[model samples]
Target: MSDDPKQVLRYPQVQAEELADWRFFLMRLHARFRTGSFVRGLELVTRIAEAAEAADHHPDVVLTYPHVDVDLHSHDVQGVTSRDVALARRISEIAAELGVEAAPREVSTLELALDVPDAAEVQPFWRAVLAYEDHGEWPEVTDPGGRNNTLWFQEAPGATGEAQQRFHLDIVVPREVAEERVDAAVAAGGTLVTDEHAPAFWILADAHGNKVCVCTADGREASGE
Candidate 1:
């Protein structure tokens, strides 16, 4: 655990057995529960909401038919903290009471993108820092463990002489639901950054200026769409 309670934990720092079947990706703790029925899922959410209210820590939830996806994080601190850990434990107990099972941790994939003035120079340092394999084919560093997010460096046009966000999140979701996710985010006060590469990836920014990219599997390769 980090010395500071509010400190964001790195991938390796988060222990596997500590999360009670939850997965840690970037700054959030994620768990997808199979409730077996839509009504059961709703019940689970209600219980979770009550628990969150009692604890004063809420999680972002998404319900899709028989599955409920719960994501816990401390947005103010910009990362997962002890608060998330505690809430995850409570969530697991609630899931158990509802007889819901969690999906495997590896079901979710996370990738980190860096906007830098030069990819060549920045890539080497990150590769060394993570002791990762050089996937020269895509020019990105790959984590051998596959537990941490893959690091990709992109060139930021005119970045050398100006200030720009260097780090951001890239969330990979199913292609069929990309549009729905993008629309939901826009409806939640997030501005759409660009859709020029529709069905491939859409960039969106929160009111606080933090940027995130919603990406799909191969919409970018098929028919150059």
Candidate 2:
């Protein structure tokens, strides 16, 4: 596989059969494998580490008693590349060898969005409080260890109201699962805030009016708003 640091694969380009086990989100390929045991999960992790080392590309891995979550992205390119795809394929093969099944639909990433009138004034405070690192010069802070949800600022009017909402979550998931997630949420008493941006994002609110965005990478790259 060709490794070009400047070449970034779009969502459509990475949606190949070879990468069926992985889902693209927020510039990374995410997959969850059901290992069924801690020892089995560790063995899978070791093999994945070896594969990553051999390919000269590493992925963020989280191991637990019943599963292992893997996130792959080319740090230099700041997005998914052929290298990530190749490694993801290899990781899937390793899981298959160990009889571990992938839970692709269960892979998701969370981000916190804070509604603020002045992003610069409040960004620093949240960064300090959460001890999160800034992503370049963007108005966002992320956990350095990739353990916590990323926090970003969204500019909004400074209007005071009885039902003022200051914060909400951005649940990023695979495009295929976005609708199902929305349906489930709605069935559970959540109301549809808006689907005007369907396939890209859906704004949903709880019974009390707290809002969240169920987002996907689809319709976000090159596609018009």
Candidate 3:
């Protein structure tokens, strides 16, 4: 755990916890604001983009008429870092200036990640099996109408054997509730694989050896992308 990459701090353990007033959910600093009008939402997006540019950080912005959602995470490190926390505070300030009301509960999204030897070779089978339309670059398939969960394929560690994990679940939850979830899983008899990524993710397994990751914004997604 000590030898692993250094930027994997989870939730309140982050570098700038004091400045980050936004909610941590689904592996990103997520917040939704009621902009009151389509034009207002667009303006808010512009402000956010400018703020992001100044901070040298960017966020995934979902701008719907009268609603704007922003998700911030450090993609390179596959977790939320100090940069995300700082930027989230800036976003909140921008929202306040715009008189936007936060409705973070309204913004939540989940995705499925599958690790395989090669995404290109295995994508077709999963696509056909799930009937999800191919979209974006390699390693992603999505429901056309965005109704069902989106799927992402990742390259597995070479030759994952019986002991290595072949499949796992990444379950995202609000940052504040993360610890409780981990406790429940432990109480239910799951084994903790590692706490090195706590707040980001907790790797655990059931008695039969079926593994699942209770993941959050800081949890590293298995996908390289």
Candidate 4:
């Protein structure tokens, strides 16, 4: 609610200890424009604004002639959310549309590791499902994006006896795409764990018996509530 547009723009930054939800995004600006011309900066802001509009999410933007800094958060939820990620993707796409090549160093990836009793079985299922590849140990799964950052999965030692996971991923897809993907997952040896009574999300377990959910984007929107 800050009057200054720049102040309203939330650039991706390290989250304070109390603000853990905001840490999911990695923010970056074009280096050449960082101290460059005003007109160019305004152009960047316009492009960023367009992207935000497209995603139905607005980011906090700071403009200084040739340089612009952007921060993305879901104000509706009062924190960073998947809406922020969708907006960030659009922003990066807009930058590319404007002929501004993102510097290699400007990219970042967030790594997440999951503990499963059978790392070997769970890793391959995820790698194939997400189109990720092997990176570290045989049981590890990794997805490398532009920033050389990766989402990793490794075996949790002594985890064979646990019957339930403390955390899991909710794989969201468009409503039309959900059944196909769910069927494919089932064909790949995943089992139906539970049906969400809401019909918006279905929990499925992989071969190793680890659970994940196949959900609709709208369902995710509701769950986040």
Question: What is the C-alpha local distance difference test score of each model?
Answer: 0.73, 0.80, 0.69, 0.56
Which prediction has the highest TM-score against the true structure? Answer: 2
- Residue 40's C-alpha lDDT in candidate 1? 91
Rank order by TM-score, top first?
2, 1, 3, 4
Q: How accurate is candidate 1 locally (lDDT)?
A: 0.73
Worst 10 residues of 3 by lDDT: 1-10
Give Cα distance to truth, residue 63, candidate 2, Å.
Answer: 0.5
- RMSD, model 3, all Cα superposed? 16.6
Candidate 4 lDDT by residue in tens digits, 24-113:
443322222242667867887887777777666677676766456565655444454445554555666566666654443442345666
Q: Which ten residues in a row have the lowest lDDT in candidate 2?
A: 122-131
The superposed Cα distance between candidate 2 and the true structure at residue 104, in angstroms, equals: 0.3
lDDT of 3 by residue, 1-225 (tens): 122432655765643375433677545677788988999999999999999999888888888887888878877775677777778888989988988888866767888876656666555544543345776565887766445687886776563333665566555667777777666666655567787878777776544344666667754455431
Clashes (candidate 2):
0
RMSD of each: 12.7, 14.7, 16.6, 14.5
Residue-level lDDT of model 1, residues 1-225, one tens digit each, is 665768877777677447757888756788899987889999999999999999898888878797988888886675788778888899999999878898846347567776666666555544543446776457688766544667786776555521366566666668787777777766655668898876778887654344678888766666563
Give every collision pair in model 1: none
* Total colliding residue pairs, candidate 1: 0
- In the range 155-184, model 2's lDDT, one tens digit per residue, is 776632326876666777787877877877
Which residue ranges in model 2 land beyond 4 Å of their true spot?
1-3, 159-225
Candidate with best lDDT:
2
Report how far residue 90 has shifted in candidate 3, in Å. Answer: 0.5
